[model samples]
Target: MRFEPRRHTSDDERILPLINVVFLLLIFFMLAGTLSAMDPFEITPPRSASSGEDNPRDIVVLVGADGRLALDGTPVAEADFEAALAAQLTESEGARVRLKADGHADATHVVALMERLRAAGVTRVLLLTIRDEA
Candidate 1:
């Protein structure tokens, strides 16, 4: 009697190529995709006294929730804010500022403030934010 040809059947043989294709797609996406940084939504940073230790001329600019502004804890009027910051910059060796904006503060206002700070010859501006504790 003649023997029929043996047929090889295995589920793994069918799936092996699919697994390789999936892994290749995964690597392709990982390499092609760009990573971006996002701002934290909820995090409180611990209080530290060393924030200004590096620079004696470092000043903190506060932006309140109600559009109020303060330079070094002294409240400043909106119209005079630029002049006040300019004056601080003139007195300091390097124009560096720490911006402490309230969570509820307007985004436009903060950006405007940053622009003003840059226009006023501020070399650097640090945005102080609390660390996420979750």
Candidate 2:
């Protein structure tokens, strides 16, 4: 008596399940990733000795070395900075503003900006600084 041999399945059936699993995993990670602002300009932030703690800021103002001012990554005229800040402060009653200035930024420029923020009724302004590597 002769015995019959079993036939092997096609490659498409084996690969389809693996392809579907990989796509499912990719979709899961894409949905899980954090979505935040991608600031266009680059700035070497100053370092600070203090380890201060505060809640997340509602507005982030960036000051470039060439005296350029940006609010939430959008460029704005120096004259209009205060007005824009005032509008944001009014919308969020007690929200704080954070300032991120380049390392080479002038102290006077920062001070002047702070004064403007204060005039706009922003009492709490936190200066952002990077922690030095040990």
Candidate 3:
């Protein structure tokens, strides 16, 4: 009786393990990476020597250099800003909020924003800034 030798595995079979590993890596990255919503507009945060870090959980208020405003990543018209903010304040558990203002934003505007936040009953407002790399 003559037995035939086994044929070589196809290229597809050879690549199966690589494909599985690549898929596994993709899944791993997807699970391991943290995804967060980006700001509606670009903002260059002011520089500071403080080593404070930002907490992603905090609700953020954004102010652009050109006087644009966004709340929790959604653009809000200047006229509607207070109403929107007050609405959020009532539903929010904490009075804490984060202010992310552009580096070039006017100081008075920022202060006015803080006053507005205070008037709206926000007790703890954290100003976000980038660490100076000097």
The 10-residue segment of model 3 with minimum total lDDT is 50-59
TM-score attained by model 1: 0.57
Once fitted onto the true fold, the runs of candidate 1 whose alpha carbons sit more than 4 angstroms away are: 1-56
| Candidate numbers sorted by lDDT from highest down | 3, 2, 1
lDDT of all predictions: 0.76, 0.84, 0.90
Q: Which has the higher lDDT value, candidate number 2 or candidate number 3?
A: 3
lDDT of 3: 0.90
- Candidate 1 RMSD to the correct structure: 15.6
Q: After superposition, how far is residue 64 of candidate 2 from its true place, in Å?
A: 1.5
Q: Write the per-residue lDDT of candidate 3 for residues 33-106, one digit (tens) a residue.
A: 85766789999999998866666566799999998999999999999999999888877776569999999999
Better by lDDT, candidate 3 or 1:
3
Error of 1 at 48 (Å): 15
Q: Per-residue lDDT for 6-58 in model 2, tens only?
A: 88999998899999999999999987784666565787889877666656656
Model 1 global lDDT (CA atoms, 0 to 1): 0.76
